[model samples]
Target: MNKPFSDKLRAVEPYTPGEQSKNNDIIKLNANENPYPPSPKVIEAIKGFEAEKLCLYPSSSAYALTEALAQYHGLDVNQVFVGNGSDEVIALSYLAFFNSDKPIFFPDITYSFYPVWCRLFNVPYETKSVDKNFIINPKDYYSANGGVILPNPNAPTGISEGRGFIEDILDHNRDVIVIIDEAYVDFGGYSAIELINKYDNLIVVQTFSKSRSLAGMRIGAAFGSAELISLLKAVKNCYNSYPIDSVAIAAGVASVEDDAYFKNTINKVIRTRERFSQELKGLGFTVFPSHSNFVFASKPDVNAKSLFEAAKKENIYIRYFDLPRIDNFLRITIGTDEQMDIFLNFIKRYLSSLSGC
Candidate 1:
């Protein structure tokens, strides 16, 4: 029998997201979601939204959300492009700018979506290995390539590099598009949005999911020079004329306007993350210094898979990757202080049981 799918589709492997459990009783620290709720204004916006607007088509450009993001980042309206999420924005970017014969470059253990998008788009790519500590070396990215995309305060590891490091990479790759995925930058990492005006080829992509508590809303944007942003808009319009609906637009705009609440929630998560990392270290876990909302850690004597199973049995969910170089590691999102305390207690009891003490 002949297979219906094309060879390209057959060869491609998709990106697997973190497990989403339906049980309300479970402490889910797996997906790096903001444990906080959306801003009060967001709630107000949704409640006050006109139900009659559902029959009408939303703004094809997602103008309101794009304008809010532009104003938030101190960029012009032409310099911002909005999408359903940062993932869509990035996938469109891969289509818009990464058509060169040369292979693109990204860190080996960075966001797993980079390679998936490459295969999906048929874009040739190469992975540059991060150092033993899982830190990206700017020198490795200096080589000639199609383009560059990396998550600042990288996923899984949650380690971040500063502006100077990004500048070094940007200074070298002037000809190719450099996308700085800042989905987790609101937690602690410095943003490349500030440098967008300086580099024509740079595009800084961000999501409202992690920091704005709008993962359900699915709003994301990219900031770049008007020329690059226009290209992304072209690609986006070709695929989905109205990626963001009116409700999401209202919610995203409200989330951006409430600066105080955003900062307050971010600070709370940062404090919790720091305290959690310290607690993990005290438990003999080798914890990576994190700038994102999560910490990546490993304990030499404990099996990560076994620990993950143990936590799952207790209704505590964290991320465990069964991939190379990080098979022993666990990526735990920073939940509320109370939640962290509960998880810490669970860890303590689990370790105690292991020793029969």
Candidate 2:
């Protein structure tokens, strides 16, 4: 005999993260992870941490880290909500604001996790298709909806929408919550955090996993009106009171304080991404205009699944989505200049072999 599974469990298909291989030689450009390390301040903060504090519970509110983020973003402390990661913040937002008979709306090609969250929470959602170019038209979002959620500089496409476009969505959907998942904002996407005060229903969620080089810390945050933050906090309290631990809080505060390291690393990633995009085009790939840390591209002559296998054989990793509209494209993270150079060289050799040159 087996235990009965819940109806939700039967219906739910969990989100799948990008692969993490054990081989140390692999040049990992699959997941959109920051190639740089976290700020020295983060390491120093961890080194100086009080080991005795492990015996006590961490601050359930994550108050100190919240204050640091608040100062950086020019918001009141009450307007910030911290969670285990931005993914958690996103999941909590669904529970706090998106329960409705009217379906929430997101782009058809976007961060894959959005649909998973909707299914787990039992929130009805409709997937609105982006244009054939993979560009999201703001007009398509102007409709009756329970809520709106989208990632600017959309994943698997790496295209960022302008601030004016986001404002238009807010203008049309004034009655319901609009969640902007800004996980890649620091790369080149314009953050809607500036629009939060004007639109009470807008919630901008971000993560330290990308630009801050702190994916291991698992820190994510959200910004909105105080009332909106309060609702998320209430839901969080009901679930996990200490979503952020002491070490993570310390590292997050340190990462925020080191402005120089943050800008330097982000600038390097942006520069490398542009150069990589051009190199891909030279190799006969159609590289999309990307504002994120990765490029979504494909070649007319070569299949992406074939390239994925070829790259893996050479111990270089990139991502292939094997799904609708994007099956032929690969979302390759912009690693260090040296790493990308090696990847491009491998591509050249692969192309030469294919063409018998």
The positional error of residue 129 in candidate 2, measured at the CA in angstroms, is: 0.7
* lDDT, candidate 1, at 41: 99
Model 1: residue 357 alpha-carbon error in angstroms: 1.1
| The 10-residue segment with the lowest total lDDT in model 2 | 1-10
> What would the C-alpha RMSD of candidate 1 be, to one decimal place?
1.3
* Model 1 backbone overlap count: 0
Instruction: For residues 94-161, write the lDDT of model 1, one tens digit per residue.
Output: 99999999999999998999999999889999999988899899999998999999899898899898
Query: How does model 1 score by TM-score?
Result: 0.98
List where candidate 2 sits over 4 angstroms from the true fold: 1-9
Candidate 2's TM-score: 0.98
> What is each predicted model's overall lDDT from 0 to 1?
0.93, 0.93
TM-scores, all candidates, are 0.98, 0.98
Tens digits of per-residue lDDT, candidate 2, 48-88, equal 99989988889998999999999999999999999999999
